[model samples]
Target: MQSSSFLAAILFFISAAFASDSVHKYQPDDAVDLWVNKVGPFRNPQETYNYYSLPFCHPSGDAAHKRRGLGEVLGGNELIDSQIDIKFQKPVGKTTICEIELDEAQVMQFKEAIDRDYLFEFFMDDLPLWGYVGDFHSKRKGDNQHMLFTHKSITVKYNKNHIIEVRLTQQNPKPLEVGRKLDMTYSVRWIPTNITFARRFDVYLDYPFFESQIHWFSIYNSLMMMFLAGLVSTILMRTLRNDYAKYAREDDDLETLERDASEESGWKLVHGDVFRTPFSIALLSALVGTGAQLAMLILLVILFAPVGMLYIGRGAIVTTFIVCYAFTSFISGYVSGGMYSQHGGKNWIKSMILTASLFPFMCFGIGFILNTVAIFYGSLAAIPFGTMVVVFVIWAFVSFPLALLGSVVGRNWSGAPNNPCRIKTIPRPIPEKNWYLKPSVVSIVGGLLPFGSVSIEMYFVFTSFWNYRVYYTYGFMLLIFLILLIVTVCVTIIGTYFLLNVENYHWQWTSFCSAASTSVYVFLYSIYYYCMKTTMSGFFQTSFYFGHTLMFCLGLGILCGATGYLGSNLFVRRIYRNIKCD
Candidate 1:
């Protein structure tokens, strides 16, 4: 038995050595370049030329394409040397071999996409081909040693004229998982590669129904807005007419006047302190200013998206956003500082600083955490250190200073008006509120109408961001945005009216919070989408996704809150100024 065991071990060792020799580890003398073409969905059955290549794995050909200028790309002009060339191609008879290394995070991303069975259609020189990435496999060579690699095959055929046609076919559709290695290696090959494809291109349109759905949603949202607006207008007119009529009937008898004063009810009673500066006016102003800036930013981006001006490059929208935000810093400062001064605030500088930095700080802090995680995971998605430094410089010098300048100008530009109502020296006792009338209840309920107006459209936006679907329906988005604003204003006004009728003078913050609650629903919907719709896994993707979502929700909150406050402010001022109060 011992002799037999020794012979078996020796035989196993020899076999292991032979098996290991068959597969050699790849070593490239120069940088390995992989070309990633435009990614599209399989369901879209068009000719597939409309998809633009992603810039992450840009090749030498892109440089030449950009040199032709934006007009050539945007104006439907001639194709300007945009095809990526495969320089490493060998003789048609010999199999071409190359090693591609992917970071662990990237592998995880690919795995997530593949696990969902997303078929990305690829285009080469206008020839459309489709494929899905498969699982990573490890084969035991011998002696407990294993070789790891992912396999994919692309078949090509050559005609009599040597014109080549490439066909993409799935070899093994196994689910992929990230291994222990920080970088995963894959061996790719073109099997039976007859030869190259002669240059010919065609344009294909897909997702035709996507545009139609946007139009339908826009109309639905507009109808909802109109309903809410009409309801609020009717209620406000009736209530205001009654209040004015009652006030118009003067009670000249001193005893009757005293009784009426003692029994005073409705908004007229709180007129003395309704416009009194809310607690922490600085923070309130800052929020309003930030909200205004974000609202404008969103509107401008939506307007420009369909025009193809903002999406110039892979990161061009981000760059445009940053630059525009910096320039728009003045709007935040001016709005916040002006409103604060008008409300008799003393700390204009504090309000301005908070206006400029509060939202940005939240965004940066979350981004830093996400970027750090990406870096630790060896993901190329992380922003480079130098780029972060440049961003800081721009924020500090450009955005911050412009905000300060705007604040100074606003503070100096004085045209103070006498307050519509005189504040009483002693504070009136607030009545005990019912459970349903509490601020918390009001806020949650007030957000519903506004949220409902955009909920359907929000799904598409989320899917576009995470599911990698191309979104190009800005016209519909713009209409939805307007409808959302309308709903927010009308709902907030109704809520403010109720609070005032109850003699609650603290409508300033409540008005903002109530409308801003739409963001809360938005965040909740995002959580639901992540749990139910997406196949994304891994700690890095989760953290990045939530962090960004939080920032987005916060921006939405700001925009809605600001819109509510401005609308309420106008309504309150106009009504109070017109009323005759003794």
Candidate 2:
């Protein structure tokens, strides 16, 4: 009975979520809801505030608000019901909404909003419409006047019973004055259209920009780079094979053996120290584990988004990401635990804790700072206290426990040390090499190719996020992602081989950093993009833009770092496997 009740509850929850998003068929004279969403400056996309934050006329009594999902709240949406009475297929002529007695305070507010170029957003039957608050004009030299729009004209187009489009036009501009009596009025017109509801969002998609020749050319260039990276890897493998044959030849005379030993001063000389536990093994393991989880999470989201039409919903992407991250916490713990154990680490508790909280705590710290900024500015971007608590509960109860369970399972299953070479009792002293051969240099240079491979795609992704463009090309994104991974692995492998060739055994962190440095270049490019492409000004929008970009870079860094390390590990083991180790 308890199990049955639980299943029923789950089903009801799912149904409720889907039901709110389902299309509605309206009968003639049935009331349609107009939802007032948010208002913000035209230049700043993320800096939004509640619709009622401005001195707009409110409903006489208590107003109804729409309940939003987890994603919607995170995306900074607060939808309030606009009590404009309208019926389906019923056209209403100019009707007075309210009389706003403009006092000094209201005049000041209107002037400020006009100066900032604020725009209001409304939703009717799930279709969105936008209109500016007011405009400013110069009647003569040194004589400027601020005008407020007092009339709203809404045109709704429908096919049969389904609303297909909604448009808003602001009219009746009245000069702002201290004792002005401005009448707020609205008119609604219902028109029949042959367009279907499914094709309504097509108007918002910029197909020419997304599918241009430049975009396809970029993809082709990335593909060519991938093949080049593959060629480099194949060459490295062949060279390693030749070394293996020479080192494994037992019939060589003592004189020949001695000559060969004298000549072999590169990677072959460091076999004994190659498998030694790296410095800060626990932190490295945790980061790698987190990266693995992010890699899988991004792949899953990209695959699921197009298939499910996740773009149609307001906050569906964020909601899906949070839920998927929770479920995939197991992957983080599993990878961290196995890596820690394999490296002979004894602090199981520390490893588990770090694996679970590292990335999340970093994000939370950044979010806390950004949220404070939002709150100070009275922006709707500030996450509410209740939403924060809900996220915490989900992480604590669901993500943490799953991580713990995965750690235990991983420790028992794949924690055995299986290095191809044994660690020496004492570490070999790393000889100084040329400045160009240094780990720092190699790490920096290693990321160049990988960054180049995905640089074009990054521009598209950034524009879509910050410039109000819908990104529907997950297929292009997936291909670019795969190319990035391949290039990162191939480049890091080459870097690791060079480090080892210099008789350095600290290839682990070096390899990771080599690939992870791609994020540094990406962050720098974001700075350039911000300066050149966007006209956003003010502290709030600036902080949010760079803060979010930092978060993205951190995740990308971790993902690439982990992939590099894993690839290098395979390469190191393969090359050493056939060679005789002392």
Candidate 3:
């Protein structure tokens, strides 16, 4: 009797596993619907696209009228085209959710599909925004490839002239188990009037990533900032007290000066030539100019992001970046020209040209290579030709002339008191340094501290970029950015003081290198992130990842390098100005 009972229980469970389908019919009162396409990882199986839905659903009513803009001339809009509708049999059962079958001619559109590793995206008001998600990995035994399926319950209806309308109810408690029937229903009393789905997407999907796990990162960065601040403060106080006493005695009398002359060591000895401009002054000036421009752009972006100025629409932030960068060209030329002239550079025109060309040349050269790869792969991520032309036009007409005008103004007021001590015609012999005091050793060690301060936050940034997730916590990001700047400047100042103590006065590049080497750490961390954190694969993904990152690092190197150099220069000037150097 016990054995019979066990057999009956097993039969009951099996019957429950294969339950019958329960279809939820489409309702007219539903506010909005998004029909999902085949879902897969960044690297999907070739057949996945062949089987996914063709270009069926598009704007039919008022939506097409509203989404039109001047940018529509660039020609990526599919909603503007006549609707190509095809009819297929009504999906039969719950098993029908497992596949979306399209014929050969219909499948040709899929052939030219952009190779985005995204799992799912839907068109809202003719703009494709990422929100939908689905299981891509095959479940069948012995099958080793990504599979496509309907993640949510979808209801289909045929309209006039082959147009098809879909009412898609989101799947609840996702990744439905193999055994049970999957049925879902979504209700809306009124339709969403927003042109883009960004707002709704942010509320539903993006908020969780930003809010969760940020507390730990915040705590870590805050502690680092406090530690660095305290360390710098202590050093500043001790150094100032000692230096003041010695300099005060020097100005008192000949007897007091003679007694303290032998004891005068470290940075005081280098005061005579501390402000003497180093070689490649023009390039250094340009770097500093460009860095300042970028720093301002970043600062404004961070401040604006929290205020929602740059967060309103698709590509708004990018547009802000481009426009701000262009307008900031004058600042770059003005600063570079002023610094160069102070350092005894004669040709103001050359300084302007160098400052204006440095950033754009590097950016466009690297960008073109990466964009070519994107285009070859049919990726929508590639910048359009028209957009590139617009960028170029902005650079040529607005930015270049502004740079020239600023340079002319900078040269007019370039006669600032740059040197604390008069430059001697003959060069002073720089004393040889110990092993730890060498340039290479100092640079490597200098960057590590700053890198540590920002390392935790960088993980989230990379995840947002590579994983196609949303990043909305600009407030936290802004705090971390401030901390990073503080840490970089402080660490560079400390390193500069030490290098000067070792009798090495060539600090222009060393100070820059000391801070800029943080980019090396960032790049290495990116490699580690790629290997461990992401599942992306393919030649295009690999090429784009490393190539684009290299440029990013280069830009950061310039920014941090300039920041560190400027801080060190300020410290050096301040210390030398108060000293009694004969």
- Candidate with maximal TM-score: 2
Rank order (by lDDT, best first):
2, 1, 3
| Alpha-carbon RMSD, each predicted model | 15.2, 3.8, 14.4
lDDT of 1 by residue, 12-108 (tens): 8775443321221112221112223333233321111222321123224343322222222222122223233232222222232332345566556
Cα lDDT tens digits, model 2, 409-464, are 88889899999888889888898889999999999998888998999988899999
Clashing pairs in 3: 42-117
Model 3 misplacement above 4 A? 1-120, 126-201, 213-216, 250-264, 414-417
Better of 1 and 2 by lDDT: 2
Which candidate should be chosen as best, given lDDT against the real structure? 2
In terms of lDDT, model 3 sits at 0.64
lDDT of 2: 0.89
Task: State the TM-score for model 1.
Answer: 0.72
Clashing pairs in 2: none
lDDT per model vs. reference = 0.65, 0.89, 0.64
Candidate 2 local Cα displacement, residue 130, angstroms: 1.2
Q: Is candidate 2 or candidate 3 better by lDDT?
A: 2
Off by over 4 Å in 1: 1-131, 135-206, 212-215, 251-255, 309-312, 414-417
Candidate 1, clashing residue pairs?
none
Segments of candidate 2 deviating more than 4 angstroms:
1-22, 249-255, 259-262
